[model samples]
Target: MKHPVELLALKQTHEQCLAHADALGEALADMRVRALDAASYEHLDKDDRRLLDQFAYRYTRLQDDMGAKLMPAVLRALGEDIAAMPALDRFARLEQLGWLASADDWATLRQIRNAFAHDYPDSAQERFERLQAAASAASQLMDCLGLISRQMLQRFGDLH
Candidate 1:
């Protein structure tokens, strides 16, 4: 691939992914210091709520960028035609290339992300459950980003 521009795009996407990953890590770490329960969740402090918002926003952003932008850029850089490939197939191909851990895990994360997008105002329990599941799944999303980052570094070397 004799395309410096593609490399530049890939580097930019990789940087965005890393930024999301770092934010997610910080939010999760700050959150873990004080665990949450049904009662505690009902009342979160301003900072805690902000952290939650940060985590939720970044989780969605990271996955969306990976699936929508980064994945296609990566495939193109690797000499694959992804002009018409669906999202899941893109994940499958990344997994095949050893850039992703499991396409299934990525799909599960997508489901969790979708849950976050919808609002059920009258259902606190449902929201709490989703927060619980998404928090756990958020770590997995981080892991996936880490894997892709390493693979990118190996393939492209010092994207910065």
Candidate 2:
């Protein structure tokens, strides 16, 4: 790749994104082991609380890095002018370029992330359901990152 230096930085961001996804995935796995309901959710053990916290933190970090840092870096590496592009514009451009599967999907994922971030469910049932939804969305987001990784490999033939 002509942009060896640029690809190197992209590679770093890509690895970091993967790490976040992996951690989130593990948390989701932990989530699945517990048959949590509203009541159960309210009385989680310390370990369960840690796992939930991990899930929330990793999910946000992964989305933020991918949208705010990695996506722009990817565009910049591909010679696109992304300095002024809104995040939605970046997603649309990536979709138009055949890199992203669908910008709409990305928007949905963002909504899920935002909902998980800001929502303080008044009902334990709502919190339980929200956690379930977030876990599914986290898995989908991880898949999206995997797709992006495959695309990167196809384009550059090995980032290292």
Candidate 3:
């Protein structure tokens, strides 16, 4: 790739996201094994609750940073004329270029991440359900990021 420096920077960001995701997953592993429902969430110790909260926050941040920041930077680095395009169009272009499996999935992942911003203090059940969904969506986002990274390396040549 002509922009090897930019590629290296993107790789660094990718590595950071991977580390955050791995840490969050490790924290959630024990709590997840318990099959948490709303009632189950209520019974969790302070530390476990904190971990769950971190998972929700960090996952959304990861998704947002990747889509809004890392991905657009990547597309530009690859010489895609995406400066005037909306975010959806950029994703569509990435999909068309075979870097992304589905642009719709990327958009849906953003929607799912955004849903986590709402607070359902009045409905514990709804909040718990949202958390569950966010966790699953976060996993999917991580997989998609991995796929995109691999594709980028294959096309641009791995700098590392």
In model 3, the clashing pairs are none
Per-residue lDDT of 41 in model 2: 90
TM-score of each: 0.92, 0.94, 0.88
* lDDT (Cα, tens digit) per residue for candidate 2, span 79-115: 8887788889999999998778899999998898888
Each model's lDDT comes to 0.84, 0.86, 0.76
lDDT of 3 by residue, 30-134 (tens): 557756789866567787677787787778778877887778767877877776899889888888878778999988877777777765555678778888778
What is the Cα-based lDDT of residue 116 in candidate 3?
74
Runs of candidate 3 with Cα error greater than 4 angstroms are none
User: Which is the better candidate, 1 or 3, if ranked by TM-score?
Assistant: 1
Which residue pairs come into collision in candidate 1? none
Q: After superposition, how far is residue 79 of candidate 2 from its true place, in Å?
A: 1.1
Using TM-score as the measure, the top candidate is: 2
C-alpha lDDT of candidate 2 relative to the true structure:
0.86
Best by lDDT: 2
Ranked by TM-score, the better of candidates 1 and 2 is 2
Query: What does candidate 1's lDDT look like per residue over 1-160, in tens digits?
Result: 5388888988898889889889888888877886767677777898878888898888888889988998888988888898889988989999999999999988988988888766554566677788888888889888888888888888888767
Report the lDDT of model 2 for residue 5: 72
